[model samples]
Target: MVNIANYNDLVVGDRVIEAGNSENFQTGDWRSLIPVIDIDKCIDCFTCWIYCPDDCIIIKDDMIVGIKATHCKGCGICAKACPKKAITMTPEE
Candidate 1:
Protein backbone atom coordinates (compact mmCIF):
# COMPACT_ATOMS: atom_id res chain seq x y z
CA MET A 1 0.00 0.00 0.00
CA VAL A 2 1.12 3.58 -0.75
CA ASN A 3 1.10 6.11 2.06
CA ILE A 4 0.17 9.64 1.08
CA ALA A 5 0.15 12.71 3.29
CA ASN A 6 -3.15 14.53 3.50
CA TYR A 7 -3.48 18.34 3.45
CA ASN A 8 -3.84 18.30 7.24
CA ASP A 9 -0.53 16.43 7.49
CA LEU A 10 1.44 18.95 5.43
CA VAL A 11 3.90 21.46 6.87
CA VAL A 12 2.76 25.08 7.27
CA GLY A 13 5.89 26.92 6.16
CA ASP A 14 7.36 27.59 2.73
CA ARG A 15 10.20 25.13 2.60
CA VAL A 16 12.48 24.06 -0.23
CA ILE A 17 13.38 20.40 0.11
CA GLU A 18 15.17 20.35 -3.26
CA ALA A 19 17.11 22.67 -5.52
CA GLY A 20 15.24 24.64 -8.22
CA ASN A 21 14.15 22.41 -11.09
CA SER A 22 12.68 25.07 -13.40
CA GLU A 23 15.24 24.30 -16.09
CA ASN A 24 13.51 21.02 -16.75
CA PHE A 25 10.37 22.83 -17.93
CA GLN A 26 9.86 24.88 -21.06
CA THR A 27 7.29 27.51 -19.96
CA GLY A 28 7.56 30.01 -22.82
CA ASP A 29 4.58 28.68 -24.71
CA TRP A 30 2.37 29.93 -21.87
CA ARG A 31 3.36 33.55 -22.49
CA SER A 32 0.95 35.99 -24.13
CA LEU A 33 3.61 38.63 -24.65
CA ILE A 34 7.10 38.50 -26.14
CA PRO A 35 10.01 40.83 -25.53
CA VAL A 36 11.76 42.60 -28.35
CA ILE A 37 15.10 44.32 -27.94
CA ASP A 38 16.34 47.35 -29.74
CA ILE A 39 20.07 46.80 -29.85
CA ASP A 40 20.74 50.46 -30.64
CA LYS A 41 19.16 51.57 -27.35
CA CYS A 42 20.82 48.87 -25.31
CA ILE A 43 23.77 49.96 -23.20
CA ASP A 44 24.61 46.43 -22.04
CA CYS A 45 24.03 47.38 -18.41
CA PHE A 46 22.50 43.94 -17.79
CA THR A 47 19.36 45.33 -16.19
CA CYS A 48 17.25 42.85 -18.11
CA TRP A 49 19.47 39.98 -17.08
CA ILE A 50 19.25 41.04 -13.46
CA TYR A 51 15.45 41.27 -13.40
CA CYS A 52 14.57 38.19 -15.44
CA PRO A 53 12.79 35.65 -13.22
CA ASP A 54 13.26 32.81 -15.72
CA ASP A 55 16.93 33.57 -16.52
CA CYS A 56 15.83 34.09 -20.09
CA ILE A 57 18.22 36.94 -20.79
CA ILE A 58 21.18 35.81 -22.84
CA ILE A 59 24.57 37.26 -22.13
CA LYS A 60 27.91 36.98 -23.92
CA ASP A 61 31.31 38.49 -23.13
CA ASP A 62 29.82 40.39 -20.19
CA MET A 63 27.26 41.97 -22.53
CA ILE A 64 23.55 41.49 -23.01
CA VAL A 65 22.95 39.59 -26.26
CA GLY A 66 19.40 38.26 -26.60
CA ILE A 67 16.52 36.45 -24.96
CA LYS A 68 16.23 32.69 -24.57
CA ALA A 69 12.66 32.25 -25.75
CA THR A 70 12.39 28.57 -24.90
CA HIS A 71 12.27 29.17 -21.15
CA CYS A 72 10.96 32.72 -21.17
CA LYS A 73 7.43 33.14 -19.83
CA GLY A 74 7.25 36.75 -21.08
CA CYS A 75 6.28 38.17 -17.73
CA GLY A 76 7.51 41.62 -18.87
CA ILE A 77 9.79 41.94 -15.89
CA CYS A 78 12.86 42.40 -18.05
CA ALA A 79 11.26 45.06 -20.22
CA LYS A 80 10.14 47.03 -17.19
CA ALA A 81 13.62 46.82 -15.65
CA CYS A 82 15.52 48.30 -18.58
CA PRO A 83 16.68 51.79 -17.64
CA LYS A 84 17.25 52.74 -21.27
CA LYS A 85 13.87 51.49 -22.45
CA ALA A 86 15.72 49.16 -24.75
CA ILE A 87 13.43 46.23 -24.20
CA THR A 88 9.81 46.28 -25.30
CA MET A 89 7.05 43.77 -24.74
CA THR A 90 4.88 42.96 -27.73
CA PRO A 91 1.89 40.72 -28.21
CA GLU A 92 2.89 37.19 -29.09
CA GLU A 93 2.00 36.20 -32.65
Candidate 2:
Protein backbone atom coordinates (compact mmCIF):
# COMPACT_ATOMS: atom_id res chain seq x y z
CA MET A 1 0.00 0.00 0.00
CA VAL A 2 1.10 3.52 -0.63
CA ASN A 3 2.32 5.39 2.39
CA ILE A 4 -0.70 7.27 3.76
CA ALA A 5 1.57 10.01 5.03
CA ASN A 6 2.65 10.70 1.46
CA TYR A 7 -0.88 11.14 0.24
CA ASN A 8 -0.86 14.76 1.28
CA ASP A 9 2.20 15.28 -0.88
CA LEU A 10 0.50 14.04 -3.99
CA VAL A 11 -1.00 16.45 -6.47
CA VAL A 12 -4.50 16.21 -7.87
CA GLY A 13 -3.23 14.15 -10.78
CA ASP A 14 -1.68 11.54 -8.51
CA ARG A 15 -4.66 9.53 -7.50
CA VAL A 16 -5.77 5.94 -7.60
CA ILE A 17 -7.67 4.91 -10.67
CA GLU A 18 -9.99 2.01 -11.32
CA ALA A 19 -11.58 -0.35 -8.85
CA GLY A 20 -9.47 -2.31 -6.31
CA ASN A 21 -6.49 -0.11 -6.95
CA SER A 22 -5.40 -0.48 -3.35
CA GLU A 23 -4.24 -4.01 -4.11
CA ASN A 24 -1.25 -2.56 -5.89
CA PHE A 25 0.02 -0.88 -2.75
CA GLN A 26 0.04 -3.82 -0.31
CA THR A 27 -0.63 -1.46 2.61
CA GLY A 28 -1.45 -4.08 5.22
CA ASP A 29 2.21 -4.48 6.08
CA TRP A 30 2.16 -0.99 7.51
CA ARG A 31 -0.48 -1.75 10.06
CA SER A 32 0.32 -2.16 13.75
CA LEU A 33 -2.86 -4.11 14.42
CA ILE A 34 -4.53 -7.01 12.66
CA PRO A 35 -8.13 -7.99 12.32
CA VAL A 36 -9.20 -11.47 13.22
CA ILE A 37 -12.49 -13.01 12.19
CA ASP A 38 -14.51 -15.34 14.31
CA ILE A 39 -16.14 -17.48 11.69
CA ASP A 40 -18.42 -19.14 14.20
CA LYS A 41 -19.76 -15.78 15.28
CA CYS A 42 -19.94 -14.34 11.81
CA ILE A 43 -23.41 -14.15 10.33
CA ASP A 44 -22.04 -13.49 6.89
CA CYS A 45 -23.68 -10.08 6.99
CA PHE A 46 -20.79 -8.54 5.03
CA THR A 47 -20.66 -5.47 7.23
CA CYS A 48 -16.88 -5.74 7.42
CA TRP A 49 -16.47 -6.15 3.71
CA ILE A 50 -18.50 -3.03 3.01
CA TYR A 51 -16.75 -0.91 5.62
CA CYS A 52 -13.12 -1.88 4.94
CA PRO A 53 -11.32 1.22 3.74
CA ASP A 54 -8.60 -0.85 2.09
CA ASP A 55 -10.97 -3.41 0.63
CA CYS A 56 -9.14 -6.22 2.44
CA ILE A 57 -12.16 -8.26 3.34
CA ILE A 58 -12.59 -11.34 1.20
CA ILE A 59 -15.98 -12.57 0.15
CA LYS A 60 -16.97 -15.74 -1.62
CA ASP A 61 -20.41 -16.87 -2.72
CA ASP A 62 -21.77 -13.85 -0.85
CA MET A 63 -20.19 -15.12 2.35
CA ILE A 64 -17.52 -13.23 4.22
CA VAL A 65 -14.60 -15.64 4.23
CA GLY A 66 -11.80 -13.66 5.86
CA ILE A 67 -9.55 -10.66 5.65
CA LYS A 68 -6.54 -10.07 3.42
CA ALA A 69 -3.93 -9.25 6.01
CA THR A 70 -1.47 -8.16 3.35
CA HIS A 71 -3.72 -5.27 2.40
CA CYS A 72 -5.42 -4.50 5.66
CA LYS A 73 -4.25 -1.45 7.62
CA GLY A 74 -5.43 -2.77 10.99
CA CYS A 75 -8.24 -0.28 11.13
CA GLY A 76 -10.85 -1.38 13.65
CA ILE A 77 -13.75 -0.15 11.58
CA CYS A 78 -14.57 -3.69 10.59
CA ALA A 79 -14.88 -4.82 14.17
CA LYS A 80 -16.98 -1.81 15.09
CA ALA A 81 -19.21 -2.17 12.06
CA CYS A 82 -19.95 -5.83 12.52
CA PRO A 83 -23.42 -6.28 13.90
CA LYS A 84 -22.51 -9.78 14.98
CA LYS A 85 -19.27 -8.64 16.58
CA ALA A 86 -17.45 -11.30 14.61
CA ILE A 87 -14.38 -9.25 13.91
CA THR A 88 -11.77 -8.16 16.39
CA MET A 89 -8.65 -6.07 16.05
CA THR A 90 -5.53 -7.40 17.75
CA PRO A 91 -2.07 -6.02 18.04
CA GLU A 92 0.43 -7.60 15.69
CA GLU A 93 3.26 -9.61 17.29
Count of steric clashes across candidates, in order? 0, 3
Query: Tens digits of per-residue lDDT for model 2 on 2-91?
Result: 546665666578565578665577887789988899999999878788888888889998888888988888879999999988888888
Listed in order, each prediction's TM-score against the native is 0.75, 0.74
Q: Cα lDDT for residue 87, model 2?
A: 82
Per-residue alpha-carbon lDDT of model 1 for 2-90, expressed as tens digits?
88768676556755455776677799898888999999999999888888988999989988888899999989999898999999999
RMSD of 2: 5.7
Ten-residue stretch with the least lDDT total in model 2: 2-11
Stretches of model 2 off by over 4 angstroms after superposition: 1-21
- Considering every candidate listed, which one attains the maximal lDDT? 1
